[model samples]
Target: MKTYRYLDLITALFVVVLIVSNVASTKVVLLGPFTFDGGTILFPLAYIFGDVLTEVYGYKRSRRVIWTGFFLLMLAALTFGLVNLLPTPADPQSQGTAQAFSTILGLVPRIVLGSLVAYWVGEFVNSFILAKLKIATQGRWLWVRTIGSTLVGQGLDTGIFLLIAFYGVWDNSLLWTVFVSNYVFKVGVEVLFTPVTYAVVGFLKRREGEDYYDRDTDFNPFALGR
Candidate 1:
């Protein structure tokens, strides 16, 4: 393994925030009569960072970050489960708080699984496509690669997450609507942030003295030993 850099730590922290915010965002509420999960606001940032990691550091480093996120998510879910399983105080107020905590934390397993699977799938796809496009285009047309990869990657992430998390629970039509709408919203966020993404990628590459091309990378998601 290579020596750790300070920015890598920052990247890891952002990944954790992304996972936590994603799990917490499942609660739907009305925003001007349009119902949406709070997760929508934070989830796109994960993809943006995903793009940054892959673009600046390469697939191997990005894979490490992804796996770091995976373990952190698992630890969080396990901690939540353990906390929820412990006995609560007898006071009615305490009991209510415990119940609320349990209700939120109890969804950890499913949500964690959905997030892990979607993230692994979507991120790898995004990185792989972008890496290949970078080589094919000789690193020209950054916007096309970023937007194109997000279109496919976010689509897969949205579809997989919705199907796994709410398959039989939601009617097919409603499920499809949710999936499509979330996909559009996520991709829209990516599109809107393209300029920021460009700036960040450029700054990171210059500061880190690395604009990696994964020409020799092993694209396997499970090959974390790289």
Candidate 2:
């Protein structure tokens, strides 16, 4: 019912970053023998922001933001599909470029599906846990809620996304490796950023004059009406 001037804008930006990072995440480059997917670097921030949204704004508001992101991703996937389906120019060079675009964009469906599912589950878990912890601790120990929620939320997110996106494509061992690596990387990012999270949460609470408890809020992920 209520809207903040910058909430929608922030949600839009988060969604755009999520989509771009997912697309760019295909490559795992070595940083002096320490290898990591490029996406792993930026992807955890989305969760951090997600936690902030839910912790400060409540589940209803966070739900709207998450659904907005899901729809935006679907729109992006549809556009990619349409572009790939359209006929390329007669020039061989143009055709090659078109094919390359298709190769990159064609993976959108699986990636988007996995993303939507993982995001929905993981974010809700983070928020639900944070809200409960906030009440239980009477809003004390902010770091505990943030890091504790992330440990659970990021674990589910990494596992679900990898399993849904790459389960059968890679060998079992490789799949497990990716699962472990991504999970550790994401959770590590959350732990490292805990200080930043505390600062942001403090600032938002002070500025917004709101520290939502979600005492009477619904936790249903499918109830978009909230």
Candidate 3:
């Protein structure tokens, strides 16, 4: 029953990033030589937030935030699907914007399922591993836990999401290429942002007087009881 000044703010930011990432995933874009879904640019920041959450607050709090994200994502996908299903009014000259709405906001069932599943799994894994590493390292070497957890978490996330979202829909070689690109890029972001992560974690730990250790935490993704 502990409270932190910034936990709510952090969780809100995490949810916002996740929702935006989903919205942006509709377009495959080329950035320089790399071709990736638009989400690829914004998606990795969720992991950075994930690291910050677990690192500062511990696994149990992070688990609640992860489940919060999962529920919100599911609700978003559900709402988008229902909205897309509504009938568009008929007009002879109407360049129907309904179709455009559908194209933009409609959820692909497979991709939605993949995204929710991958996000739930990957975030929990990231939180759990970071919590464990915090204890193992005796709370030293913040970079190790952040980057190490991202390496594993983002790997699972990118691979599982791409496989489910694009395996049959995309060319085989392109699928693997995108998978590799996504994974490498996500992990790379964690490395590049390590200093930022350290600064945030340090500030939160000091301000909130909570550098929690999850030694006795349940680590259950489904159990959100507080």
lDDT of 1: 0.79
Model 2 scores a C-alpha lDDT of 0.79
Alpha-carbon RMSD to native, per candidate: 2.0, 1.9, 1.3
Q: What digit string (tens of lDDT, one per residue) describes model 2 on residues 1-226? A: 6656556666877797778867777676544433455678788888888878877887778877877877886777778878888898899999899988987776656766787788778877887888788888888888888888998998898788877877787788876767677777788888899899888877887777778887888878778785
How far is 48's C-alpha from truth in model 2 (Å)? Answer: 0.5
TM-score of each candidate?
A: 0.91, 0.91, 0.96
Task: Score candidate 3 by lDDT.
Answer: 0.88
lDDT against the true structure, per candidate, is 0.79, 0.79, 0.88
Question: How many pairs of residues collide in each model?
Answer: 0, 0, 0
**Which run of 10 residues does model 3 get worst, by summed lDDT?**
87-96
53-82: candidate 3 lDDT, tens digit per residue: 988888888888888899999999999999
Enumerate residue pairs that collide in model 1. none
Which is the leading candidate under TM-score? 3
Candidate 1 similarity to native, TM-score:
0.91
Using alpha carbons, what is the TM-score of model 3? 0.96
Residue 22 of model 1 has an lDDT of 70
Q: Show where candidate 1 strays beyond 4 Å.
A: 1-6, 30-35
